[model samples]
Target: MSQARPDHLTWRHRLVALAMGLSLLVLVVRMVELQVVNHERYIEQAADTRASGAATLTAPRGAILDATGYPLAISIDTWDIYIDRYVWAQDPDAASGAAIALAGMLGLDADQLMASGTSDDRGDILVQRRLPYERGAAIEEADLWGIRSLPSSIRSYPEGDLAGPLIGYVGLDNEGLWGVESDFDHLLRGQPGWVLHERDAVGRPIAFGQHAERAPEPGGEVQLTIDRFIQDIVERHLREALLEYQSSSGSILVMDPYTGAILAMASMPAVDLSAVGTDGAPEGEALAGSVRNRALTDLYEPGSVFKTITTAAALDLGLVNAESGYEDTGVAEVGGYAIRNWDFQAYGWVTVREYLQRSLNTGSVWLSQLIGAENFYDYVERFGFGEPTHIGLSGEAEGMIRTPEDQDWYPVDLATNSYGQGMAATPLQVLTAINSFANGGLLMRPYIVSRVVTNDEVRSYEPVEVRRVVSPATARTMANLMRDVVEGVEWHGARVDGYTVAGKTGTTIVSIPTGYDFDTTIASFAGFLPYERPAVSVLVKIDQPGGDVNLGGQVAAPVFAGVAADIMEYLDIPPSEQLVAGQ
Candidate 1:
């Protein structure tokens, strides 16, 4: 042993030997794992690990624009504020100040800000979400430790509640939640561009800038048929009616009858699109109770506006001539059920045209019986009842009609349906049904968007015709009669000067505690303008207008009138009837 000690190995030599042995052992184990034990698992893990450094692609969501290229909704650069609670805990006093200051800068409630204290379960707490650039900058200047700002985009509506339901807002994840925003999501959500970058073991950006970058793909733009000026006019009149009649809520819409392009769509008590949170309970009295698009989604009895379709159908089937006379006894009995006039006044020996003008229920029941139930049903389906126009918009309802096979088909159903009672349909459906008169008896698909544009190209959509429900002559005759209604009779209040106004009033009985036969009611109006040119159509609906006992003429007709007046003047349409006729 003493002789061997004379030739002892150096520390460097020993270290080399130990390192070689450990390397050999590691190689053997790795070889066994890769070749036999878990080869496939390792391979899959390797494949998945490649995504560790993969970049996230951001697709630019398309904007919604008005006829004048004003943005109803747009994506703007914003930031989200967060904090590492553990890091924040290292300095509690400073950390609490940072959170409070962030809340103040972002206009957050003090209690909500206090909830993100050091003891929060999330190691990292989100201090603020979707902070505007100025607010984010202000927070950054505060120089708070452990706080971070992440880049993002927000959907902003510049005009606030204008066309609120028609042009809906989006969520933080770039998903469309409602209305047009949800309808055209795929079209609005463009292909996302990405960055393929190299990251370290901890998934941090590499210092060498070793990455491949691709520019973001912005979504295509959507241009709607909505006219902002007309929309404003309609909103004003709707509000006026709400005040005068003390209604619960209301909606207004304008469309092109031939093309079926919606020009203006509005609902009262509209929520603020710019607000970060809309789903939660309202904080103030100014908040609107229901801002959903009532025109396209809410279903109700269409009243006399629906009468136009029935009258047209009867005339088209040759069951009744416009000059034909009906004996009106104030009430008509169907299956032993009596249907009376709204005012309980009899229209004795009234002509078909006069019945429509008076919106007499007895006359409509007579027309339905004369046309026959089977034939009347055929006309209703032909008029697009119980079916969505398939305008490619989200949340559109097909409405309700008792089919021949469906249950609850009482004889009274047919009788009451003749005068637009005991059946439900959306406003858009009603408008499209009315358009049968404007499109030469051919129905056009009701749609809101007129065009889609991209940086590379612009695409336009024309009016797509569905089918001919009646003869062109019948449509013309009906249009002429509708013109007479707005330009001459009870609905004369709905007329616009220098334009031929054609429309019908609807005072549907509410379906609440008191139903179709009860005293509670919803007031509404549906019409089309410039009867000759047939460029635009309008519909206005007011829910539960409790005062004045006004039908559609008092509450909704004025809205239709204001919108038509503004649009006709803007288009410079020649007066189809004199200004005196409207008055």
Candidate 2:
């Protein structure tokens, strides 16, 4: 107005000033919002852009130790190799040369490596997994482009094939798969950790860059009740017998009868656990019977091992005493089915104790009638048959028993079941049931793991009594009767030199689809040593042994003797005064 400028020029000047003021105001508002109101959001975004990579730290699996603290299964640090496809794509000639060189070092095919490293779609590709220290070190020395390695672990068994099936195995994902591994997987597998590191714009980790990491927690250790020394002895003798008998297969279990702690358990035709991979199959051995622990899973007629259960039931019910006399016509008829003893010969009149010593079928049938079918079934159930032991192992089977409530139950069922026929039981079940006598009529829950050592504390497992099957007096009387069996002339093969062993021998015809196969039989023996104290219980079983020497006394009893003799000497058990004086 002072200069008297034109009206259009004045309007243009005013408009320019207004636009400048608006721009300043907007800039100030934006600065305040970014620096104060939205400060945390922006900062987080910036940090996200700076963090280029993350890595996982695998935790070491716990060691499986024996009672003496010897490691059965352990994890060793290793390396895993990887290839960056984007880096290799930069140069064709260099990529080809690197692929060939890597293949030669890793014993891999050249074409496979080239294909793996030349993929533009995939960022990082696996070149190899779980390589040993020496092999990984050799590859690292090459230091080729696009090649890298990280730390890892591989499972190893120091004592190969010893407790192989029981210790179980791990999978490629560093997870437990079978046996104790599968049973206590959460306790054995430790917590995994992770790391976040800053990287430059080129996707390479910046030198001295900011990083954050969480340290991994190693898994707790597992202490088993297995005794390596005793296990070794059992395996040695079992292997010899397996080959000598020319039998289909066999198994032996040595347990602390009072505690139900398995000291040594061996299965013949064993799979080399060290040779097995993450796939859970053995490479060299036949896979049919190798993978499964037959003692827990397989069921057979049990033959004479079932007789002890019947004897204990009779004595507990007061249906028969050791001195009770019965007339044996060599055969007993039930439901029109004529059953005879193993010898198929009549001994005329014999005491009830002679029934167990001689393993008489007619005498057991007669006793079963005196106890009645209903009472007989109740006694069998009390002995823990027809159910799984819940031994913390997978694939445990419950044996079959026909009771009075079942539609198929008949009078003949009573006679056959009394003598261990027409019903099925697993080796574990037979062993556990017979163990009641040794445990002072107390049935205990069997367990393999004895202790667990964690970073925080250590826990020791105690013997758990499940139930009492008989009175203490009755148990003592039954023990005495079994002692006579071991001392009898027919069972002289089973007698230990210094120990008053009490056991029963069984030989029964194999049942087939058509009927009992008279030519084939399963031989078995169950006994406990140091008769007075009863430190250990042993069960030896041979399946389908060829030739005429297939009797339990001939094939299975000697194994019991050999194993017991070694165990007594190793344990430093003193011989009885009776034994010393006799010697």
Candidate 3:
């Protein structure tokens, strides 16, 4: 009645009011969905915008030390530099200029770096790895846009290639790839840590951004039994001998017979640790062959070295004495095959002492026949043949020995094997077997790693005695016989001045797929010095020696004398006369 509005205007006002109410209801429902149902999802999306990520912090690898705690291989702190591709892509001109500056400082290609930054699908592009700490710090301080650096490390060999094959090398990712590095990788590569933090637009850590981090734990130190001085001595002599003999390759191993601790093991041709995987490094088959630690990996006929085991078994069983005599017509017919002395000279009758000194193949077969096939093979197994030495190195060969039980076994096989043919053994196996005589007939398990030092504790590896192969009386008698072999002869090549040497020489015709090579031979000597109080047992093997002088006494025994003399002097072990006088 006060203002009787038109009916049309009142209805229009009601519709407008309803539409406003519906719009208000829709706004409330949308707010509830975003704040409640999708709350965590939106938060994560927002985090993505702030460039939040967990950065890996690489832990430093451990050091490999020698017997006297000298570092052979180690890792030093460095830095890995990267460019934020996303940030670089946003500004091409700025990326180019920054790349040029970095390239100038780091000796990199400027154009290539820029191209990689822009075209790489990854958000972070690796510009450089293993930059020296000082250089990396300088780069970081410069704060160049789109560039970042993270702490890293690189494997370093202070002694260079001194023990390269044994110490091994690492890959670009800071992981051990060979030798002790590969064998003890778990202990060498410590646990890595990480940091969760927000980054700025250019992928740099934001000063005030939320952050959390866990410190990295460094790896434990590996202590090897190898003596650096002894290693150097062995390597020096071995190289000289290889060159003199014109040998294709060789191995020299020195061990502590009592403890079976490896003092020095050198195998040529050696791989240079620092130069491995570089521009001029060996590749494919050559690389594979170069990296091998041949002392334990390569197998060959033990030759007359196997005679030592046969004689020991016969003496232990009382089947033969040092004075036991055998008739030698220069050759013995066994199983329709003729076995002859190394010199192929007929000695109508020879004592056991002469058998070893002369290295007569017929004499070895005579002893084997007396010992019987079962007893001979038993001695072989007891001496740790046909098995690996388990010296804690990779690629060790388990040697091959066929017995009467095998289908290929024949009576002739026994005759040949008695003189170290029709069988195979590694240089390590030959040494360890001969080492039994020096250790009073006790077989000891050889080991390379002496100890491991960690932040929490120090673990030392003790000497392990596997078994006794003969009586101490038998061992003494054998030692005496071996001593006679060296000293009994006038001007013996194996004789060391002022030291009583006990040893055996071995020379084998190189076997091929068709048969033995008439032109090549493997010359070797296995021996120990100061026989009454043995300190070191050594094995020297020279493969495929050139020229006509390839006999063990001519080529290998002289090298042994030189090496043993130097080692005795270095260890301050008194001469044989002094030792005997003290006793």
Candidate 4:
């Protein structure tokens, strides 16, 4: 028998029992709260862990249209076929059958598709890309296991290869790769949406499972300043010029002088949008060679075409007048270098009009000397040389100009630069600079896209005037001088039947890493038509004409005439009475 327990010990035992009961009560209350109050939260958490899948809803890329609202580049509904690897791994036999069925239906390699689906890494495997909408819909309706179809699109050019380089193309992911596509990709590619759905063990979307989706927003419509008819005419004339002149390559640009709108731009060896990625399409270096918009990318000496700038500067500064006389000894000596005229003949005591008509290099050197280096370079910079025009295009080059501040600068450079040698400029830059004359001495920034239309609003772009390079009087005088140059019998090739063309011809020797290629020349012409009220400013350049006759007036001038004449007629521009009277 045990002795009677102490009172203190008994109380302690009772207290311990009370603490245990209280702890148990607290636990039961917490369990009730978790199970009843927050039941749905836990349920959602568990479901999320079990099935999590999301997919992108591709947005249709924007359509690129011409000024007349004709589509140049568009996106057509398509589909991307994918294989769920984990689901396929779960059943090898099913995977093989699916691959064979897909191969027969969509023209794919069964063995390759099977291997891709059964690879060690488990994820979605892309089996085919850019399938037609109807075919993809049929595949989806068949309900093949582990096979998936995602909404997609393929870029289509309805006009075929008409403006391939200018409109550019998209890549496999629908990302822009060149030209307008690359430059304005942000506006062209719309925001993509997404979908969330309950998935199975292999992360494949479950049929009839809970689904939620956000609709994709389509891209905006880009309206370019380009005219389809004008582009066709320019391209036709450029191709013909290249063939007739036996030139390796060529480019043509037509711009509205008053508005600085690019009506048409064409480059040779252009990629055909319809044939890209096909069996016979250009690839690697060949594709790269053909894809560039040479008018804005390639740099070359403007030759005599640059003389327009020199003459304008001189007239603007009052350094020379149209009747100012100069002695042409066939050569002008500067910095121990002899600069001679194209014909290597002397015209004794010639006026400024005669010198320009003859395209005398000596006369250009004399005028540059009068304007001085500082003022001449200042004028050049004001006219937008040695810099990019920032014309919203990919791969636009900023041409090189040597100034007195540079280490390589020489005194002879002033003379050569005046005649458009010992320096370089893109064809677009040359045209833009000369366009100042037609625009009444105002230099306007060149642009391609005229407006962008979106679902919500339309943003129209206007002509941007940069600055005035010369006085209106000086511009009028220069225009008259240019008109005289084109009207001269020697440059008859540049004449239009019912138009007075104010123009200049350029024939530059191809400069190489080692000296120059004397056998080849870049023949070019820059001009504006209707003399009094200029409608279009045109530039035509042909590279490396074979055989004889590589002069700009002979090879490129005729091309300009053809393009300008057609454009004038298409635009319903009437023949000028001034031109007819002058003729």
Instruction: Please name the candidate that would achieve the greatest lDDT relative to the true structure.
Output: 4
lDDT of 3 by residue, 1-583 (tens): 4987667657678999999999999999998888998865565555556543555678999999999999998999998899887668777888888899888889999999888888953368778889999999888888876887888898898888897778888898778878999999888989876555677665655679766566678998999999999999999999999999999899999999999999999999988776787898898878777778999999999899888899999999999899999898998999888787878798879999998888899899999999999999999999999999888888999999899999989998888998898899999999988888888899999999999987788999999998999998888888888898889877878888889999998999999999999789999999998897999999999998887699888999999999999999899989899899899
Model 2 has an lDDT value of 0.82
By TM-score, the candidates rank as 3, 4, 2, 1
Model 3 residue runs over 4 Å out of place are: 1-52, 89-104, 107-122, 198-210
Determine the C-alpha RMSD for candidate 4 after optimal superposition of all C-alphas. Answer: 8.0
What is residue 312's positional error in candidate 4, in angstroms?
A: 0.9
lDDT per residue, candidate 1, 389-488, as tens digits?
8977777788988855667798888888888888889988888888888778988887778889987889898888888899998998898778777776
Q: Note each model's CA RMSD in angstroms.
A: 10.3, 9.1, 10.1, 8.0
Model 4 global lDDT (CA atoms, 0 to 1) = 0.88
lDDT of each: 0.77, 0.82, 0.88, 0.88
| Model 4 regions lying over 4 Å from their true place | 1-52, 83-127, 141-147, 204-210, 578-583
lDDT of 1: 0.77
Across 1-583, the per-residue lDDT of candidate 4 in tens digits comes to: 8998666767788999999999999999999888998865554555546533656778999999999999999999998888888778889999889989998898889898888888853567777788999999999887787898988888988888987888888988778888788888888889776666677766765789866666778998899999999999999998888888898888999999987899999999799887787998899988887888999999999999999899899999998899998888999999999888889899899888988888899999999999999999999999999999989887899999999999999999999999999999999999999999998999999999999988889999999999999999999999999999998656478899888889999999999999899888999999998897898999999998887799998888888899889988998777888546656
Q: So what's the TM-score on candidate 4?
A: 0.85
Q: Quick one: how many clashes does candidate 2 have?
A: 0
Model 3 clash pairs? none
